[model samples]
Target chain A: MSMGSEKKAKRVRIAPFITILFFLIMGIVGIMTGEVRRVLEQAVQVCLSCIGIG
Target chain B: MEIVRKWIQTIMALLVNGSWSFPFTRTIYQGPLKVVCSPGLNCYSCPASTTYCPIGSLQQLMAGIRIAIENGQNFFGLYVVGTMGVLGGVFGRLICGWACPFGLIQELLHKIPSRKFSIPQKLNYIKYGFLLFFVFLLPLTVVDKFGYGELWFCKYVCPAGTLEAGLPMLMLQPALGQTIGLVFFNKLAILVGFILWSILASRPFCRTTCPLGAFYALFKKLKLVKLRHIEENCTRCEACHSVCPMGVKFNESPENAECISCLKCMDKACKFDAITLEIAGLPMGSRAGARIHRPKQGEVSM
Candidate 1:
């Protein structure tokens, strides 16, 4: 097998597992800490016009 | 499809920031929808911006977490980080191709008649530095006496902030011009420099300095949506590599972070249909058929 194909197969095998693991950890932490509410509050308010538009 | 995606993304950007009647509105959109993160790097400070820029929100969360830690309060920026990870995991840099207004702007600038140039592959890592220092580190560590961390990336580097918010804000309210100091001009200069660079090299900023792009790029390997290469069918023709605007050698690394999933190197460039789009490993777009033409014996496929 060529180098590209070999690498592609290896990555495909590992990637999905890593992605799922990351999301699982993050979800647990966010729920436990109430960080979701904090993020929502920050998202709602526009800050001082630093970039000039808002 | 890329063009259609671009138009849809541009309209989404405009519509999301659709509070035009309040052009001089200093207050941000404080609606229920604001809790959702925008996929693109649209500036939250823009008068019309209803949802928050993920990068900005990430920085805010980082800074806040740092301050909370200092104050001995329990705080962690899990939500912003989690949302970003989910988006990045699902789409990778496809967001750059289909959603970002700034990415659209860079592409439009690149389309102007000019001599095109390519950046060194090594330079791609600079965006990570911006994410680490400007967006996260500096904002968390570099606090004033009042214990307030400045939004370094938004203030100093993000051209999207300047174009979407700063310039328009200045134009709308001339009285605020006096407050425009070294920081504003410095950002404006960076924005102008990026504009020139984009005209010369497609997505110069996206490739070299966009922290948001860097953040999403980390998930390129695990992304649900991806570009796939079928080794059996490839003629080793470099058409895909040659046509790639980001200069990714996709034949070798179909899921490289630098690939924005523009699909230019797929059906258009590959006559043999060697390359394809894939969602969760399911094949998409046109399928591979017979080789366009057999290569003569001993001719190099690479």
Candidate 2:
């Protein structure tokens, strides 16, 4: 297999895991502290703003 | 679909303005337990907010003159900014795009029938200058010996304050009207001007004024959500740029800091299905190259 193919396959799997892991970590922290929860929410808002959803 | 999306955006803003509570809400909702972020950047001290605004909260964080919370140990002014930064850094600019109730008001104003005026290219840079000169430098450097933090925008201007804070407070507590100073009237005039301008333009605030938008724009390259360009299929027509209000050259960099990701231009202009949102479908993945732009050097020094 070529190096490019190996990298693509690895990235595809890792990307989804990374995305999910981020939300999971945020959720756990959000539940623990009011500040963390608010920060996570603000993060979501910032994401939408960059995209013009806010 | 564009109209539909805009309407959906409108409703969401109303809900946030009315219900979503954040730190700023904590300032006004002292009577009963409530949390609500305003639809716009209104001052928490204005006495009219049904909800607290994030920027308003930053100002409120410094409401009293006693800066040393633990007897000169903790710096609240810096902390106020930290609150916004942590929020801005994590979510990027999504708050401005969808959740901000004031943004909703701007969107609705855009629907009003009027001749739209495009801002001159030269004046477009004003937001950045305002960011550096007014927002950070002046506020940080010029301090009142009494220790009350100076909020230039909130105190003398900011229409969001009038609509969300000023008007509401005055109406709710008519007694305040008797003691109103010239500052209230001056700020009201600026707010009214912004309102009138909003009717003729599409989110005048977002386009050239919002400091928060400026911050999130700095993070567009590495934001969690991505707007990808399928280069192989792109016709180089540059339709995206022509339609984009921000004048973003989407073909060169779809995720340019200026890009609000409204996706309207993409939805309307992309006849070739060249721009899309997804995670690793072969056609989409093959287009934008493998390298995601790493977060640049001090792109956001804030």
Candidate 3:
């Protein structure tokens, strides 16, 4: 593959990088602001009820 | 007969409970005498399960509202998935092959009578996308009214969760049934879909849905535990391909991250033992080292 093609592949892989960055930010905000943590808790409870599995 | 022995052992371990159950059964079996039992996905959350499952634990942690406390310390119970991943990067998804309850479930599902099928090749990569979006990103980003993260796949798509925890919980604690809603039906649909797909294929969960498998796949090439192919001896006969349930082209890379390290092709085929587990440190290639193992006479693949 040409250098340009290789660069394109690397660029495509950028999605993963963005994804990882997003999660890291969320995790930090969750741990620091506690807002994210609270959201996570409510989500889990809602899911439990939704699935009807307790 | 060997399969029967494995079944007996698994049942006994489950009934006995305690540490004798599950994965410990796996560890003991791997102690020297290898004994594999149970051919389906059976996470520790299953009423039948005796050991704690990492996937189930991860889901529970993500979904858990209240964590129990013991001995003056708060314990998230089974929130060991993150630890598993940290350590997995060390030995990797060997757990998928040996210890994972769900992986076992999929294997057993292959035994059901049906016309096996493999999804379109290019479409298979959709799993990595699932891993990223459903397993990781969504869970991390999508919060609830309260603030804790959501285990997106477990809450939304995991059949293992539905079967292992949902069905059994509802059956054992029928009161739980009254709470059922549209989400219940949605998960039920997903559970049924995967079960139907498994009957037609081998491990639909492992191939396209398992986040744990996805995590391990990332470390597959780097981990010393790998399927090695002595390429110099390879004849390119593609014997391993026919035997592989995951539909991986083994010879393309001896150790592809997609592999569960089930060793089915190597044990049954590979007349020359050309494809074998090599402990020596070898960097993973872009893909994997393709291995073509010839199955022995009278050996039937799932």
Best by lDDT: 1
Q: Output the TM-score of candidate 2.
A: 0.68
Badly placed stretches (over 4 Å) of model 3 are A1-47, A50-54, B1-45, B48-53, B56-82, B282-302
Question: Model 3 misses residue B48 by how many Å?
Answer: 5.1
lDDT by residue for model 2 (B1-302), tens: 36665676766655444433434432232322123434334344433234445554443334322544534433343433443444444445555655566667787887789898765545556666655554555555566776645555566556666666566655554565776777777777777788888888767777677665665566554444445676545667677767765557788877666666666555777665567654332223332232333333433211
In DockQ terms, which candidate is top? 1
What DockQ do the predictions score, one after another? 0.38, 0.07, 0.07
lDDT of 3 at B239: 77
Compared with the real two-chain complex, what DockQ does model 1 have? 0.38
Per-residue CA lDDT of model 1 for B4-103, tens digit only, reads: 7778778877866866655545545666667667888888777677777878877776667657767765556666677778888888898888788888
Worst 10 residues of 2 chain B by lDDT: B26-35
**TM of each candidate vs. truth:** 0.87, 0.68, 0.65
Give the per-residue lDDT digits (tens) of candidate 3, residues B1-302.
23543464455445422333323322211121111112223444344443334443444454443322222323332224333444354446655666555566666777898877886666556668777787556655566665456666666777876876678656665676777877778899988888788888877778777776776777665554556675544566777888777787888866676776666666655555456564433323222344444555554434
Best by TM-score: 1
Error of 1 at B169 (Å): 1.5
The regions of model 2 sitting more than 4 angstroms off are: A1-54, B1-4, B19-28, B31-51, B60-66, B69-91, B278-302
lDDT: the better of candidates 1 and 3: 1
Q: For candidate 1, what is the lDDT?
A: 0.77
Better of 2 and 3 by TM-score: 2
